[model samples]
Target: MTEHLDPDAMLVAYDAQLRAHVPPVLPAGVTAEHDGPLLRMVGFDHGGFVVPYRDLSGLDSAELDALIARQRDFFAARGERFEWKLYGHDLPADLPDRLIAAGFEPEELETVVIGPAAPLARPPVLPEGVTLREVSSRADLDRIAAMEEAVWGEDRQWLAEGLEKEIAADPDSVTVVVAEADGTVVSAGWVRYVPGTEFAGLWGGSTLAQWRGRGIYKALVAYRAIRAVERGYTYLQVDASPDSRPILNRLGLASITTTTPYVWSPAE
Candidate 1:
């Protein structure tokens, strides 16, 4: 039976799950600093400075505005360009559209899906000559990153670096796996098992164009779920793109809600 869920309630549940499980994978040199009611990070990337913000609810409107302004000043003083990522459902009703007024532009909406970890434990069948392997070395990591880059058309250097850091920081908490055929990776993904949270997040599920519809992606997801359950995670969550949503749906993951980001970039 399809269980009907209230969108608002689902959003709250999804947010809590995300906050608990998938804490921001901030880039290197990006420190997470809390300023009373504001949780922000500053990443000193060669591209410029990236500032990502999360709402800290203890503050009233006036205090929140003051904190935002202070962050802007701090970054400006460092001669860095700033970018703010505002989640769609996070804007307070009483708060003015100051971010937009500050020139933030809305980006595409993404869906947050969550479901039990059990469904992913089931074994998946891949096409002939394909096999799944868990990555354990720097060489494997590079290969996985390269496959992801080729599949998604994005430079995955950042992702590889982040994963390497996580594995080094907490070896038991991170897992990267790839599906390969005749020594070439065709699909890949990773899962992060966050302590103190009931969720495990699946990330970077990219498959080669020629590999679509062959159950490689689903098998990768199942592999992660199995690992998540083994580590006692009750929920599996993903910020799914449209290409992956249908597969997740077929796997019984419910779409909790949509998450859109409003971006404030220096160029805008």
Candidate 2:
């Protein structure tokens, strides 16, 4: 982390590590299966997830088209929604178009940013009257869902369900924290110390509208970074939204790729 980092080289390592299935096992309620080069996780509370390993270069046009359709049917049979995690650098260049043609809808684009965790583990910097606390109770989890709902104007009941299952399976691998002021949760986030990898994935940082630009989000990042560092992780990673991408970049995480989700919902 001290010497100048070669972003390209580090990114290559990150891709390789991910392709190897760094976690190696899904949570208890979920399962993984392979469709040729693509690995899919099924039974998440939200639905299935396609791992974005970026290994589609070898498939021909027809073969790729069939692969996309197959995933759609696979999920439809179970009446579940699914997502194909597509990155800007994923090969076949037309993969995004192919997904769209298969009835998949593209969602928000995010940057895949990563950085050395050591430097980011400084004491959290929160605004006056704000305090961050690590959370575990069901009440705390419900509060996080409420915070997310207020930020995005939708029911986020799925967050509590998924986080509960994950925490029950391995308390050591995940950490959830919330920023509180005036006895209410204002911002929340979590970090997963993915097993068998050098990286810890950071999720959330959903702050209430009234709390924007107050450094609570950044403090959440720093707090998660500290947990990652203490847990022996070398790098911190996030699929950064536009609002957070600039802040993370300034904090030293390199934006190596752009990830956009292409989703398919089962017909009612």
Candidate 3:
């Protein structure tokens, strides 16, 4: 499927639809600011996130430096950390270096992979002792956070809070699912249907290390794809990690570009 896909065309649509999109509504405590040449999503329990799709190629170094500093100061003055998302195809080739020089630390680079959803909407094939189920509740969200903590060996309490906000903002736009073994959470993932677009984003497919390589991750993806198709969404998207990129590639999605988060903190 990927062989027939035009990466350039996919990126064109992605930029036009997802990148250019500004949220029409946000839940309480969250707000969007359309600063000059930038759109910043702020007040998340996790922190702020700058939309990755802006064009900065026209700005010279000093102009760009001022722009970057403005964002850093905006968040810092609020005593918060925020992220500026940079895509690999973004012009002004030295942008990353400039961001680093300005004290923004770069996070891991992730591939932005996408493909039509219809092809991935197959019936999931789960291994023995595991079952897939859609969930909605603070309890379920807490369970997912615990599983995520075990998967990454870190505190994930914020995940529960963030998911709650997302679900509250628009329950129809998001679907959360978990894979369980003997009633214990083993793997999980979610789908968020991008409003007014053909895309549905698959996020947070984390499985416990003990359960890795057991078809659980792929099954969760299949479940999300099925949900996407049923919701009238035509395509699927993922910010694929190195571990997930190969699986998504085999599942028919191909990377169109890469995105790295350049983070700045008010606190050292």
Query: Stretches of candidate 3 above 4 Å error?
Result: 52-54
Each candidate's TM vs. the true structure? 0.80, 0.96, 0.97
In candidate 3, what are the lDDT values of residues 89-124, reduced to their tens digit?
987888899889988999999999998898889999
Best by TM-score: 3
Colliding pairs, model 3: none
Per-residue lDDT of model 2, residues 137-168, tens digit only: 88899999999999999999889888888888
Report, for all candidates in order, the number of backbone clashes.
0, 0, 0
Please rank every candidate by TM-score, starting with the best: 3, 2, 1
- Assess candidate 3 and give its TM-score to the true structure: 0.97
* Candidate 2 TM-score versus the reference: 0.96
Give candidate 2 misplaced runs (Cα > 4 Å).
1-3, 19-25
**lDDT of predicted model 1:** 0.69
Candidate 3, residue 217: the lDDT equals 93
